[model samples]
Target chain A: MKPTNILFTCAGRRNYLINYFKEALNNEGLIIATDMSANAPALADADIAITVPSIYDENYISTIKDICLQHKVTAVISLNDLELPLLAKHKSNFNNIGVKVLISNEDVIDIAFDKWKFYQFLMKEKLTTPKTFIHIDEAIAETENNTLSYPLILKPRWGSSSIGIETVDTKEELILVHKLLLIKLKKTILYKASEKEINTAILIQEKIKGSEYGLDILNDFNGNYYGTFAREKLAMRSGETDKAISVITPEILAIGEKISLLLRHSGNLDCDIFIAENKIYILEFNPRFGGGYPFSHEAGINTAAIYIAWLKNEKIKASFNNYKSNITFAKCDRLLKIKSNS
Target chain B: MKPTNILFTCAGRRNYLINYFKEALNNEGLIIATDMSANAPALADADIAITVPSIYDENYISTIKDICLQHKVTAVISLNDLELPLLAKHKSNFNNIGVKVLISNEDVIDIAFDKWKFYQFLMKEKLTTPKTFIHIDEAIAETENNTLSYPLILKPRWGSSSIGIETVDTKEELILVHKLLLIKLKKTILYKASEKEINTAILIQEKIKGSEYGLDILNDFNGNYYGTFAREKLAMRSGETDKAISVITPEILAIGEKISLLLRHSGNLDCDIFIAENKIYILEFNPRFGGGYPFSHEAGINTAAIYIAWLKNEKIKASFNNYKSNITFAKCDRLLKIKSNS
Candidate 1:
């Protein structure tokens, strides 16, 4: 088989895409690596490496474009969100240079990147999701009118890893938090302003209260839902699950199928859901693989392989039924320490 | 009156926000300007001007951050989506430096950015929306199985201004379109690959077939639906209405209110709806100010002022009831060529 020339941009050290490519293609591939950090683990294994600034930098796109042209790169895949838009911006340029960028257009990426808009879309579709609020005034009014129960959660609409999240127990606290949030938003925008500018600030949201679950799914370009894995969170930090167990509950699986039907989502995704009061509410959707996605693969869901096959336009047999029952998985971060005796 | 320092970032020569701010604040604000293009139209009137690359570029943030620190800028208001995230990212940094960013957190931005995810979130809440898809596969399967009818349209899940859209007349066309789409996605992803990476690509969506309309809304951080303007599309390019007439049909207005209640969106938003065969299908949501928004504002809806007031934590009188009938408004973009002979 002829080898495919793939350029993995923003492929961090912990990316599962690397291993999946290696295993599926039998190491018959070339890689061009670009990253902000010189010590990024993926660089050592790449065919070529270039150290660049953060993807958010102004020169990042031009730099990538030049490098792709210089090395005759074939495909570019982003392992993170910040790089996704860059890839998108230069997709046509890459095309002109005979390279492929596996991302949607700039406008699409803009929509995919914002959480509040995503919620609005979901709510508009009548999908099952936890109750959420995007406006601080609306949330405060709800609080004052006792529209929501006490012990509610507050979160920023676009934050990740649990930043700016708080649990409030009273209307006074909600009001105080709103004031603080407005001040913070104002301050941040002002800090980025020029000598004579004003500050534009942040949006506040009412958080959902419940146990969270995740669904990992892969779909083909034709928008067919090929594979899905429902995993229950055994332990979580902020909004991420540190310890999760794969559960093949038919109920959850059916729900996953329903979501797949609804969004027709292609590529890899992690669907977050909340089970509160014995009802399921989808919290959010992540279009790409999450940090701890390997657990799902270990539980017999080869999402990466399916995605690869789909890209090649090959028919894949959905064989995920083998590990469909009460599969348990766990993830932990460990810092290696040398023994004193040594 | 205190001169509230405001920073306005614009792309190219556009300074629409300057006029909006001037009109809203009654010329009581100091407007600092930054644009990548040195000849930007707004630069001439700006109190202070700085040239920077696109807001998505890292240099833009760095430049803005430095400027904010030096000037003690009061507020940062972005006129585009590209700058919104950068303002949001350094929000905390601005707080530490004593400035303000009038935007939401990155998470909120993420959800707000992606239409497919937003639709799913809304669906979960049991809100009313047109049936939509995120994948082409599901759309094709449904069509083949005789689930969907003719006159269906295909759209990009995260698209704007109606790019890459097609209307289907039959199943054969749908299949042909689906195949073409598959090839397009693969080609796009493959072209960017090096020698060993796999390609992943875009999502496909179902088209809402019917009479389409747009609704502009302004909410506070508290989630209250404060102000709204209902407009009917008179002419459209792609899915975006290039020319529209402001209308206040009770049915449309009531639907907009229901959507506002459901989405709990704040600031400026444009919600698209389809009324076909006497049924309303909430098609998609644009969480930011749209291009044709000025028309609605000119038709007696001060959505811009309402947004500003909400940002300032001031009470706003809802003006949605003012326009109770169809008010005709016209818009067109024209190019002028100067003659050297003159």
Candidate 2:
């Protein structure tokens, strides 16, 4: 077996994932973690913790490349959503150094990161999605034309998790929240959104009331479709799945297969969908292990183990993807301590 | 079928549960909600939104009693964990008024609400639990003796959610957080805990590291033993289950059976257990529909509907408690907009 040396970029609070991978490596390899903060709890749990510059820093990629070379990293995985595009754009550079960056292609990552483009991608595939407007005036016009309803969802065009999301039931609340988002984004140190792609700070979409589902769609390195595992969201907090149960609904699986074939992502593709009025609607896409992946992992899907097996050119058991249904789980806060050497 | 008028006391954000009961009644019954805030989103979804005094107010129970009598409420349910004891104490008063308050016995509620008592109960039952200490000196000594490890969990003797929870790896951090919790508790509006019961602001418990599971143990009014449905926690936010997958492990289920027999809680009993080193450790218990109930509900355990049926003296199907395994679920934020009748 090729010795596995995995590197996690922007490892914030995902100490659990790092530990899981560490266990998967079975002490055969080391797990290296990098974050901008030396105090990031997850970094302390890694075999090697390196504090690096932030994602937007010009030295970010070079710093990671150097880490990869220094540590002989065989795989590079990023925990932050914003880092995916950059990693995908520089996949070849890492590949030249014999490092495999676990990310989708540039087009896929671009569509996944940009909300407007994601909505268009879904619409182009003739899939149902909430009607989204990139401009405030167009959103207002659509609302006036009775094409949209009250209790609209306004969010940053380029956002992760549920930050900057506001639900406005009236045009007044919409106008106020829209303006507030712009002001907030201008001052938001975390948001790296641009004003050019979006006419303002956020995109307005009709809030579809329905049961939500989180899916982990699998694809082989050759972009071949595997099955999809879905969990109906029972409770959510901070835009993460708080409580959910794995389900084997054929329709949802079919939708996953359709999207997988269309997007052609070569690994774990996290997707959000809503079932409103008995019709499935595609909501959002993140081409990485979402905060909800642990659900699939715990339900016997073993995506992490499967990824490792696939990378090692080992024959994977088909049963790995066939997770059992009705398995429910919840998460709680955990503490990770790192002793300071300085 | 007897017409049902359900009253949810201290209804915060459980619009989904209210709507579930509403659909179960099929518009033949009314849903009334009471809270300290008229702006409570769940209250707006109710047929009648009555603003009630705080739990400590002298007229609180009387106000709820009057609402029960006026609305001819068939059932009284509480969403807040703190309110469980209050409701259980006055269950007979509601009973005299021909209203059923869905709560366990006052003893069960007392043990569930008090962390120190819960630890004692678990110890007396010979069950695994994190070693807990009420005094800081004893906690420190335990660490010194190596009976308890570092990375202790410090929180108010009586707290809910993830609030006031501080995990400290060092003795200094533990002491600091303990003092801070006391100061914070003196300012918290929700906690009506008596100062006489707590010598310190916080109870120190050994932080047991492992996979956590949330179980909804169902029982009859007589507190008879029934099966439990459990979900392993995948992720957590703000102390609530964010993502979960359901599993029917026999050992975990047997632990639920044992606890159910010991506690003898009627109706819904929510418990948290951690599997550390193959030992199941009982963490906490809440004798009400916990935030994780949606996972069980969506997994086809219709505990709400079953509770309603059990109260109505109707025969319940045995299969309601036997939910299937491996179903995964997550929670998402939904807008519950209530138009002001004013």
Candidate 3:
């Protein structure tokens, strides 16, 4: 049998994923992990760890391609929100070298990474979403018209990290925070991405107070809908799912199917949704593995093994349908010894 | 030998401690963990888990004493800053039932839990510390007199969590943030603790920018200095150490020894310090097991095993003196399954 070597890019701290892939490989393949920093915890768990240039570096793509060629990588997976769009834009480069990059197309990635675009995409698809405004004047006009109220959320349009968020309870506080956030945006790593649309880089969102749910939409390598695993977030810490329970229902399944048909994102798409007053409101989506994936994996689904089977061109429809609901999990910290000079 | 069962109170997320004690016991004892919430991740790892009332409740101390008597608890260790003072206050109650609570005296806990008291204690001991002021007027005067500078830190004097922190770069920002922080203090869990000093609940201080280091100052069950393990923090995330490398130097060792001798804290005391221009400045200390304990444990110092030996009344000094320097470790997330009715 031919080996199905996998390359994980931007593998910052997803040590669980690296271990999962290694377990599924089962001596059949190698797991190579790369990140900008050599001291990333996940690197220590990989079979082969490499430190690569930053995703924004001019020769970053070539550096990745060189690693793929030298290691005979069969597939490439990215584990970062900021690096997904880069891989999507250069998907053909890896494909031309006989390596499949598991990323969505450029349009799908843009809709997922940019908050304004995501809101517009949800509206156009007739999906429920909170009212979002890109212009401060428009948001203020809505407030004055009594159509919108206070307790609004302000966040960067192109932000992936949970920082740079402000909740304003009054109009005066909203204006002050809006000004402060604009200045703060210029000092963040998101500044480079927001430079082109600097004027409309901040989004004024209506804060939704309801139960939050996360969905992991899975598609085959051919971009065909496979399954959607949903989990209700019970607790949150540091902007990640600290505790969650698997929840499956017809409403959530239908929405997942609809998004899968509309977006057709390859592999995994981590999504956020809010349920308030029996209505489901789509929040945002990411076109790659997210922090919430571990919850879904521990519940029942073994996407890592499924991906391995797909890479080996084996029939996986019957073997991979083992997802169950009502399982719960909580995240805890573990220490990983790292090589000082790695 | 009689069973040396240990009970960890407020065992929120310190799963490593639970596992370590279990391993060290190796069937000679049982590890019991208790928290207000049944869903605390650490509880799932213990041999026996219990849910108790809040530490502020009148029945809280009695509840803990009942558990000790029933389980034949040999030692009691706390993993929370807020609970250390409570445990110390009621240490005699547990001792009357033949349970040894691994906690410092009320005076030591008070100095560790309150930032203002910690500063005063440091000054009294002639230890190097940052200039701290409990009043905004005094801080402003210092800044005006050119004794202090901009980029100051404002935080709750009685805060255990790292949420309510603000860094101000100018006079206007400092004044505005101070007002906001005071208002915020009332809405946090620390409000109850800060009620007596509500008017002066906030602290303004010089923000030190330098290499941060964490030390695990160990004292035996008799409150005698045993050893000091120091690690240089390489990175921080969400106010916790993310990556660190062990560093044993004469300067750091001396500081640790001095604090241990002066405070005489029981078991483990997590201390934070900073070095700038070859000057060591003590930040603050917590008289309980902290998030940084795992780094020290994995680096070579088996404090968990040491605690077990101390509980068993076995010789531990010669066995635990194997700590080495230059070892590095990083914190990562691991998922633990939870029972729905837990």
Candidate 2: true interface contacts recovered:
0.03
Model 3 Cα lDDT, one tens digit per residue, B138-189: 9999999999998899888994854457777878777777765665566564
Ranking of predictions according to lDDT: 3, 2, 1
Which candidate tops DockQ? 3
DockQ of 3: 0.69
Summarize candidate 1's per-residue lDDT along B1-342 as a digit string, tens digits: 445666776633334455566577666556677877554545545667777876556577778878776655666766665455557678788777766676556665555555667667768877666556655567668777878656566543432321255555656555555444444344333222211222112344456656778887666655577666877775553234545556766677677777667666546666777778877777666656665566676666665466556555666666632444355443321111111111
Query: Candidate 2 residues B289-326, lDDT tens each?
Result: 88788777766787766766777777776755557666
Off by over 4 Å in 2: A189-193, B1-342
- Candidate 1's C-alpha runs over 4 A off are A13-17, A41-49, A69-73, A104-108, A159-162, A182-207, A317-323, A334-342, B1-342
TM-scores for all predictions? 0.44, 0.54, 0.95
Local distance difference test, per candidate? 0.59, 0.79, 0.87
In Å, residue A72's CA in model 1 sits off its true spot by: 4.9
TM-score winner between 1 and 2, please give it.
Answer: 2
Docking class of 3: medium
DockQ of each: 0.01, 0.03, 0.69
Model 2's C-alpha root-mean-square deviation from the true structure amounts to 16.4
Q: Which candidate is the best by lDDT?
A: 3
The per-candidate TM-score of the B chain, in the order shown, comes to 0.78, 0.94, 0.96
Give the least accurate 10-residue stretch of model 3 chain A, judged by summed lDDT: A182-191
Cα deviation in Å at residue B260, candidate 3?
1.2
